[model samples]
Target: MIDALHIPDFPMQRTCPFDPPQEYAKLRVEHPVSQVRAPTGQIAWLVTRYEDIRMLLNDPRVSADRRHPNMPLTEEVTPQTRRNIAEVGRSLIGLDRPEHGPRRKMLMAEFTVRRMAAMRPHIQHTADELIDAMLAGPREVDLLTALALPTPTRTLCELLGLSYDARDIIQRSANAQLRRSVSAEERQQTSAELRAYVDQVVREKTAAPTDEDLLGRLVLSNRETGLYDHELMVGLTMLLLVAGHETTASMIALGVTGLLQQPEKIPGIVADPAAAAAAVEELLRYFTVVDALPRVAVGDIEVGGVTIRADEGILLSFASANWDDEAFPDAATLDLARPARKHLAFGYGIHQCIGQNLAREELHIVFRTLFSRIPTLRLGADLDDLPFKKDSNIYGIDALPVTW
Candidate 1:
């Protein structure tokens, strides 16, 4: 029975037991850490417990670099496709200290609370613009298309100094890369195009400097410290564009959907914007957007009484940890009033998400404005009929159709 349960024919292992194939709870209690096969046919250690996952995230021995030979393959791809994937792995998300340290520090100042707070008014204005457009549209609207997706897209474009007209291409490239479905040739072409665009932007900024946006700041760093080259700058800009837009947009849509599902919470969110801040934390904890953060063990370690060998790849299931009964009592239920809602939705340790403040501000504006503007907003279709992007790394509803 254990073997059968462990070897279920699934794309990814049963990371979240709550969503489907309801046997995950049993597995978590029985085997907090266990070997599971990924879709790529490689085996990896699945860490489910909240405490153990947290410890592993902070462990120096756990490396985020997927280029390491020990890292398990999560998807199947050709040799050329693998090269593109490796290039992405070179980013901070895939690096440990020393290398990750300098890059993170370089960008940290731009994402501080003060910067985010200062940007709040602009974000709110962007949200209002999008919402206004949505209201002007047909009564039955796809909220994800009308407001959720575009809000972050516009924000990121403004923040990174990218032309808003380039949003469609950027979105397509990012979606293709994350989905890992594009042909190797197609992936390479898309990447080159994005890099070229970024390079041109960098050159323009260098020629005649304008206001200091994030990109301009990085360009200045390159000139001053000689630390960032064209490649690094392109990588940084791409990272900001893709990561910044997708995650926050999905969160806003998902968080609002959660609130709509629970009608009783709508009044509270509308009554006080500050209270909605706590609600954002709960929503993040409840619906962890990033399913897992993968790491390769650099040395032998024991977590939750289960031994992990050096060089073994591990998937830290944040969704599972958030729902772990030990960490969150009545973990399955969503409680906005839950104290200390410090969840790993943005990850933990050095790799904790830098744009968390931005994400929070966007979500807060989304929920607060959404409930306030369209008090009667509700799902236009049945719950089960909603289309969700199940295969994507960031889980979200594909189209959130709604009516006022």
Candidate 2:
């Protein structure tokens, strides 16, 4: 074990706003699984290598339950707050084994490859409509607001049976939840507000349910089989609302920025629909918006030539793993044609993103439509001045100013 005083901090600071912390690259090369201190002052194992991260992610001995007292929290959570999240948080992302499997199975059909494929036309149309509005509005506009934010927000709201009017409030709350700078008290309050809104919507849907939308389907199915209850419905929809939009919204902004930096690839991605899919995968691997995933070792586990003792917290660094040279040769270089589908951007194993199929479909349509329609698109601001979401759990630019 590394000396407690010598352990590097887990969420290391970044030198460049666009890249992962330099420590991650160094650690991946030197110590693949090194002990580190978290923001919460808890010492944990920071797993950086691609092979080790994938192994640990799939290992049953690693638990995703955030309420574990020794869990390495990126954000500080009071015991009461932890209880609130564990009890009321119906997020499949945070559950393990028996509890997680059944809950995920219930919603798996909604995001299956076939189901997402069937919705391609609608996604395409939504992308087209957003781009059409962007073109008509102004030559110089903030793409993040004009397109990146709305495309996913509109699509997720439609699927979740949420009102478009609630988008602003929901987005605000989700932002607070992921931001590192937000105080624990403020985060708890925002979470409560979000839960309150979801509670109202779930209750309304339960009283008068239909199978037309995802949330409605869940409600109707629950009524039939008693598989879920009102609180579970609230938690599930809240998870969907935040996960469904924030992650994809961040991708749109960052993906567009990345494409603009390498304009030569724009034509290829825009010209060929099949190539756009590949480009999306490459972009996901290159950017890796979400930084790390938290897990706790439930049993003594060994990986990357290191042993993580039972009860030790672990942070699987997605950004570091994606850049592992062993996994992707010349990993730092972004190649649209490179087969990058194995990247952990969407994660791996059972806890892998449930909304991945939907996210990918959205990305394919958005990138294809945006570039095809605005073939002359270019950045309106200097790269250095751009504000990146350095403080948020999800990495992305705050706004992407663009002009054709």
Candidate 3:
């Protein structure tokens, strides 16, 4: 094991756009479960191997509760920042044990394969409309605004029965929360903004409730229960938006960028269901945008021949694991037909992304329609000049300029 003096800083810089920081490859074999200082200046374990990452995430001894005093913080926290963490706990991502299971089960009712299949036509229509509008306007435009951002934003807004016009309100706060470069006060401010936005929507629903959409349905069914309480529902609504919107939006843009680099591989991605599914899975693993999935070790657990003591913060590196040579052969090379569905891109176990089905459908339809209709599509900007979201908690491009 490396000495404490050499422990690297957390969220190491990525030297390659297509790969993680090379330092991860060194740690994967040498110090698989190693400690690093977070931006908050607190020590946290960085788990890098695929097998160990999978094991620990599925381990019950760890907790996802952000309220844990020792849970990883990417930035320094103030009293209000601690309050922000507590408030964020109301979301499903930060819940643990009893609260997590029941909450996830309730939300899972809306994300079943059947339910997602039903949304295919709607997603397709949305994709086509955006493309039609984009093509009519300019020969060259930023795909981020034209398709990527609006695709998930509009879908999520309509799903929650919120006006699509409120996307600016949703995107602004969501972006702020994902950026570690932002100060704690800024993070706290955005959290409150998100909370307030959700509260207003729930209030309007409570005043005139109907079973037409998710917000309305939840309100109608849990009228006399805590599940429908104003605060809880606001948290739940915010969770759905935070979980569903930004990540998928990032993936859509990055996925197109990746495919554009390998044009010969585009047909396979658009040709058939099997090929497309494999391609999506490979892209998920290839990128693994959610780089730092935080957990607190609630009990001693031996992983990677290292014992992570109780209360130690853990940041599971899905990026390193997906790219681990032991897990996926030739992990650096993107092979769409390699049957990569088992990759940890959506994560593993209970805390895995609750909105995976919706995300998958959105990406599948968006990519299929975008590439097919705009067969001549190519990057309008030089690949080297493109800005990557290295500073944000989510890994993606800031913008993708494309033209056919």
Candidate 4:
């Protein structure tokens, strides 16, 4: 039996900088599904193996309901929990089945393959404009500001029919919510402000409703089918606004860092779109940035020879699963040709990212355009001097100093 004190802390920081927590590598081989103490002072099971992570995430019996008393949180129990539920309610990611299915179905229609295909031209244009600005600005620049951050923020605003000028408002609110370093009081206040802002936008869209954008369509849906309400729209909008850009922004920065590390592989990817797309998948797997997918067991379930009793919390390590040697041989090495579609980077099951198509398109456009334009682009600072986000739930560098 693993000693309670010896059980590695959940969400351990990466020791080797670019790699996932070293504890994950050891746990996957020695005890794939081991119990651990959370930062919140609760005991929880940490699932590290790829098969176990897939099984639990796909299992209907497992609950994503964050309201559950037994749910394990990486953060300490705080007043913000109750305030969040009261003010904004659960976003799409936090809801369980029955409530989850219809809401997801309604939104899925908006993110279909055809919709992403239609957005390709705009995504391409956005990438080109950003690159033009970056190239003209300076020999030394922080890439996160010039390209990685704005590309998705602007795209999401356009897709939702919101003002690109509101990027400051949206980004500030989003950063407050995502960063673990922020105080609960501050997070709650910012979250309230964000919801109010979205609610106002929803009201405006409802007043002068258009069918062209996601928010406008949802407003139209509420009127036609009577299936949604203002609160639901606000929740959905808040989710899309934050998630739509923040995660992709993190990926862009991290992806570029990963590619710069293996500069020899850059040529093949830059020359061929097909090769670049393949490399994008590999990059997604390599930097599995999301730290953990939290869930609580509603009923007894057997996984990896361990009985997860009712009410026991489970944290699925996406980073660990992506790095599993069994799933991807020599998993540590960056192989641009690896078929990484099966990786858990976008997650799995019904709750898998609805924006995967859009995200994939954006990544393809950004990587191809950025590298092809600035063939001499290289890191401006020493690797050790760069500030990586070890504390944030999303893994990425604070800024990428680049010189071309």
Candidate 5:
């Protein structure tokens, strides 16, 4: 019997430094749903198996709402941390249907396959501009600073009708807000700053409207439906700015890093633009950026034969689920040619990422252009030397040093 309490020490379940504890693999095979201590020191069930995670994610009894009062926090989280979490929880990702239904519907048309396809040329142009700047400079460059980060940040700025030049300040505030070690006061201040910045942008867009950008459309839709209030709109905008830019940037950097690490793959990525799409899918599966989406049990639920009590929290391990042996054979390896790449890198169920298509388009354009232009691109430093952000919900390299 694998004791849940015996799981190795982990910094924070969501942080990059915190790999799935050693005992997780054994628990997946032995006891897929087992009790574990959360970062806040609260005991919660961890669901590790793929099938079980899928079931739990879609289960109505498993609520994404954190305002349920009885929701559990990780052992390491403070009251202030809980408040921050709750603020973010107000977004669609944390709501169940009929609430999630309408908000997602309002934005669904914007992110459909057709809309994303239309955005490809612009995404490609953005990638090219960034790449041109990178090549214009010295041979040595930080790919994250020059290309990976700015491309998506600019893309989202265009989509949301915000200024691209605000990327640096926005990214800095986002980083500070996401850090677990930051003092409660610091985090609160950062959140307020970010909200104020976004609120100003929203006000500007409302005053001088152009074609329907994300915020404009959202503001219009909310007025019609009377669904989301001002705070919700602000939260949603903040969510887009943070969730949209950071994760996509990480994927671009990490995907390129993955290719450079396997020199053999570079030729294929360069030779065929079509190959980049498949490669992006494989990278998402392999990198598994957003590890898990936490849910609280609204009512009693059973997952993988374990009964979860109402109000208990669960971390649905999307990363582990993607690598589940049954669903993805040879899960440890990255196979760009692998067909049927239906991974939950975007997540699953009602809360499945709303911006997935946008993310895919951005990655496709980025990698396609990068590999084709800089065929000789190589890592300038060892993987270990790369800075990984210390404490964050999203895991990614801090900087990607590259040379061509």
Candidate 6:
């Protein structure tokens, strides 16, 4: 029987900085599916096996519905929850079934092969320009501030046709939104500012809609059908802006740090595009930045040989799944050449990251260009001394100090 009082805390601490919490390995062996006390003090099942998480994500009985009373949350229970649902509507992250399918199909049009191909050149040019500026300046710099942060900030601007001049507002609001350290009021305020900014841009695009950018394309294609109105467009765009910016920036910074720790892996990756792409997959799996995907059981289901009752909350542990030896051989060691596509980095199932294609383009270009341009680049600080973003739900390096 599952013990209630002895339930482990949902988000276990990492004994080592880079590797996941050691508890996952033990749990996978003894209790792949087990109960844990959430930060909200509610009990939820934490699923640590790869096969189980993949199956549940595709299962009809599972749901991403944030409105579910039993859904586990990373943040502590607060007034912010109700306010967010009221203001944000059923975002792409929370939608299910009939609503989810069409919405995702409609948005996927923006990230089509032809569109990503066209945007690739612009992404490449932006990375090169950023490198030129960094090289022209001081030898010592924070990679987080220099290349990692601005590359995504500007690329998203170009993709959406937003004004680059407003990067301060965009970057500031995005950086603040995900931070657990910030008060609920502060996060709400930042979210409002970002939404208001996107709303302004949406209105501008609607007045003179064009097919030149993602936002413009959406406005042109959907406005005629009355399918995507002003408010919906603003909310969706705001989610894209915040989600795309913070996570990718964090990945880039963290990826660079991870690469430097094993400089031997750096040359083979930076020297070839194919190698870089493969290395990207390995890095994605290794970090598995977002620790777990929050879900709630819709009906009774037997998983990992145990029965979970309906309406009970569950967390699909991505970090644990990615590191499972059954799925990934020698998962502890970072092998850049590993056929790691099966990993759940962007996530699995319908609600998987919408901006994933865009993220790939940014990461591919940024990683390749930075190291190729500055061969002498080396870390400015030791890994033990560097600050990590443990407080944020999105795990990454807070700052990457380096010198070339």
TM-score for each of the candidates: 0.92, 0.96, 0.96, 0.96, 0.92, 0.95
- Which tens-of-lDDT digit does each residue in 61-150 have in candidate 6? 888878877778766535664456433446577777877787778789888877887889988998899889888988888889888888
Residues 1-404 of candidate 2: C-alpha lDDT, one tens digit per residue: 46767887767877776678988888887788898888789988889999998988889999988678887778776666676667544457678888888788888978888877877887888888878788778699999988888888888887777788998878888888888889889888888888888889888888888878888888777666676877777777877887778899999998998888889988988889778999999999999988788889999998888788899999999999999999999998888889999999999998888888889989988888888888999899988888887788888888888998
Worst 10 residues of 3 by lDDT: 220-229
Instruction: For residues 316-401, write the lDDT of model 1, one tens digit per residue.
Output: 88888888878889888888767635788899899899999999988888788887888999999887777766666676777899
| Candidate 1 to truth, TM | 0.92
Per-model root-mean-square deviation over C-alphas: 2.5, 1.5, 1.5, 1.6, 2.6, 1.8
lDDT of 3 by residue, 200-276 (tens): 88899989987667788777767644454677678778878877888999999999988898899888677787788
Model 2 per-residue lDDT at 125? 80
Model 5: per-residue Cα lDDT over 1-404, one tens digit each = 34655753333343333244345566678888777665556567778788888788778888888776556543234466566567667767677877788778887867889878877887889888888888889999999989888888888888887877788777887666556667667766777788888778877766765556777877776667887766677778888878887888888888887777678877786678677778888889877888756778978887787789888878777777777778888876777776636888998888888899899888888887887888888889987777876566666778888988
Off by over 4 Å in 6: 85-89
Residue pairs with backbone atoms closer than 3 Å in model 2 (clashes): none
How many pairs of residues collide in each model?
0, 0, 0, 0, 11, 0
Decide which is better by lDDT, 2 or 5. Answer: 2
Model 3 segments more than 4 A misplaced: none
TM-score of 4: 0.96
Clashing pairs in 3: none
> Which of candidates 3 and 6 reaches a greater TM-score?
3
Alpha-carbon runs more than 4 Å astray in model 1? 1-23, 180-192, 209-211
Displacement of residue 378 (Cα, Å) in model 4 is: 0.3
lDDT of model 5, residue 390: 56
